[model samples]
Each structure stands twice: as structure tokens, then as C-alpha cells.
Target: MRIYAVINQKGGVGKTTIDVNLGYGLAKSGKRVLLIDLDPQGHSTTVLGDQGAELTVKELFESGSKLGIKELAQPARVHGEVVENLDIVPSNIKLAVSAENLAARIHREKVLANALEKVKGDYDICLIDCPPTLGVLAVNGIFAADRFLIPVTYARYALDGVADLFGIISTVRETDEFNYTIIRNGYDSRTKTTNDFIEGQLEPFAANVAKTRIRKTETINQAAINAEPVFTFDAKGNGTADFEALTKEVVGLDA
Candidate 1:
């Protein structure tokens, strides 16, 4: 299966939003999308609508090969049958502890990749929502994935993140690292800062920048609060349109 990690060393870039929404958008195309929350924050778990997805990534690492995708994954938390094709491996704060406990072993890099091997065939795509730091767990995440898809916020400091994430990518690729792509996440055309970021900065680092820029919209933000996707919440909004355009570039499908 093709796996994409939605990652950035910096936070507040709408990383989780891109992960859940893109996974949901892919699912709408009839692709079976599996989303993994590698972040310790459990935002993906909450966003997926699994109130008690109580299983965290920490437990998975501790339990080793005994853990199964069915045991770890919860159906994404969207209203209606819109999420029928979506599944999620939830996460929580404890993953940070797990990372620390497992760091001594060189084989730790393959832990997540090994865990995912069990159920990789069931999905057309797997999206890992990584934390905002270049820690051990995030290293395992990059090591496990087939590709990288970065989401950048429309802010001034956003340009400062490329060097760190790129350094990690180079380290991973020295092994069996996968191909990478970078997509601009939350964009507002009216903002000069956003324009500066796109033209003056991100254009140099992004491997695959989609033609569409996810605009700032309350509907997209509100949909997250409602624990649903913009497509399911408001299909006509700019958020849905931008992501739909992104999916086309992602899978080369018309859905």
C-alpha cells in the first residue's frame, strides 16, 4: 500500500486537519484509507470521532507483534456513512513515553513499519499523522512510510521548518526511505504573508506542491469541532474544493 506521512516539525500548520480531511477525501474516492495517529496528542483520535479509542500507540509498541490493526484501529469519527471506507489507529500522550522506552534498540526504527505490515494490504493508502517534533517516534514514522506529504501553514515562520524536516528525510533515505511530496495546507490568497511564503520560501523545498491551496475557512474549522470533514459538513465550501483538487493530484482520480 502507498503510505503518506503528514508531517512538519513545526505545529499550528493544520497538519491534523490535512491528515483527517485528506484521508476522508481519499475514502470518498472509494479508496480504503487507513489513518494512523503517530502524534502523542491524540488529536487524530479525537478528530476521528472515536471517543474512547482508548488504545494509544504506546500500548502497541509495548505489546509488540501481538497487536493487530483491527485491535488498534477505530473507524474514523464522521457522521453518516461518509467514513465507511476510513479507519484509524488512534494515539495519545503516552506515545512519547513509548518512544523513550524503545529508543535504545536500533531495531526501533522498524517497529512501526513492522506493525503496519500486518494490515497494509487492506488499504489503498495509509496516512500517518506525525507529531510536531523530530523525535524518535517521528523517526520511526518516517522510516515506516512510503512517502512524505508536508502541510505548511500560511504564516511567516513556516519557511523556517524545511531544513529540519529535510535533514530527517536525508537520514531516513540513507536507509530504505520512501519518496516524498510536499503540499501547501492552509492558504489564504488575501494574505501577503501567505504569498511571501509560497513564492519566496516553500517553492524551493516542496517536492510535490499541489496546484490548490487549502483556504482559511470557518466551515473547515467548524467541521473539525463537529468531528467531521468539510466535504461531509459543507461540500460546497472552498475547503472541500481544495482538498478534492488535492486528492486528484494525489491519486490521479476524478473523485
Candidate 2:
């Protein structure tokens, strides 16, 4: 399985949006996608049409290998069978408290990795929505993922927290062993600031940036409000097309 952690230390960069949409897009394309919501906020869990889940990702860490994937994972569905082939290991506020104890355990960084190993064979893709900080939880996420997909917003200080994320990657694993992709989210070509961010701030890391930028669109918010993917909620919209292109780019890179 290809495990990709959708992460950003800086909040409100659309990490949950990317995690849900990409997982939905891949699942719609006939790939079995499992989304693990590691964020205590549980935004990904709610957006993917799952709420009040009996089991969550925190239990996997607390119980360790005792709780298997089937026990923790709940189906990602909408209106019964409207959208299928996607499962989610939901998250709750308990995860924030669980993070404290994680550091005290042996090989704490690998806790998530070990939990994922038992279920990796069941799915074609795994997308982890990490917390918005470089804490113990995010550290566990980094160790578990095969690659990192970063969602960057267009702002003057867009690259501010990127150095901290890279530092974590450098410290834990071989930087080259895992690939990193930077996607420009909430992009508006009509704005000069967006253009400047692309040219001045993001240009230095051009090699890692995905060619496709997730353009700013109201349909994205609409989809979230409806608790469905942009593709399913508004297939004709630009948001769907952008994410489809992104999914293709991600899959091609894996190839």
C-alpha cells in the first residue's frame, strides 16, 4: 500500500480537505482507500461522512496491536452506497490526551507504523490526516508514512513552518527514502499575491511542487457542508477537476 500523510504544521492550509478529497478521488477510481484521521480535531472524519464512530485511531495507539484494523476502521459511505470502497479510522478529542503517553512508550514513534502494518495489505492507498503541529502525534505520523503530501496556501509567509516539518523528516528518517510533494491549495490566479508566492516563495522548491494547484472555489466549501467529496457533490465543478488531476499526479509519481 502507498501510505501518504497529508500534513502541515501551520493550520488552515487545507490538510483535511486534501486528505478527504484525495482519498475519495482514489476510491471513486476503484482503488481501496483507507483514511486515518490522526487529527484530534476530527475534521477529516466528519467530512468523509462518518460521525459518532464507536472506534477511533486513538485506540490503536492506546491498545497497540490489540485493536486490529477491522475493529477500528469504519466504512466511508454516503446515503448507503452512494460512495464506496473507502474506510476511515476516525479520530476524537481523546487523541490529544493519548499523544502525551506516546512519548513515554518504547519506540513510540513507530506505534502508528506498527498499527498500520496489520491493515496495509487490505487497501491500495492510505491517507493519514496529521495534527497541525510537530508533536509526538505528528512524529508518529511521519514514521508511518511512505511519503508526505504538503498543502500550502498562497500567503506572504506561506513557507514559514515548512522548515520545522523538514527538520522532523530529516531527524527521523532518510530524507531521500520518502518523497515529498507540495501542492498549492486555495490558489487564485487572478490575485497578484498568489502569483508572487508561486514565483518568490515556492519557486525555490519547484522540483517538489505538484504542477496542479487546487484553485479557490466555493464548491469545496459546499462539498464540506454537504458531507461529501467535491467529485460526488459537484462533479462538474473546478474543485473536482483539480483534485482528479492531483490524484493522477500522485499515482504517476508512485509509478
Candidate number with greatest TM-score: 2
As a whole number from 0 to 100, the lDDT of residue 181 in candidate 1 is 67
Question: Where does model 1 exceed 4 Å of error?
Answer: 49-51, 63-65, 79-82, 175-178, 253-255
Per-model lDDT = 0.79, 0.84
Residue 78's lDDT within candidate 2 is 60
Give the least accurate 10-residue stretch of model 1, judged by summed lDDT.
49-58
Q: Write the per-residue lDDT of candidate 1 for residues 93-183, one digit (tens) a residue.
A: 7777887888887687788888788887889999999899998788878888777888877677875777778888788768534566667
TM-score of each: 0.90, 0.94
Query: 24 in model 2: Cα distance from truth in Å?
Result: 0.4
Clashing pairs in 2: none
Which candidate achieves the best lDDT against the true structure?
A: 2
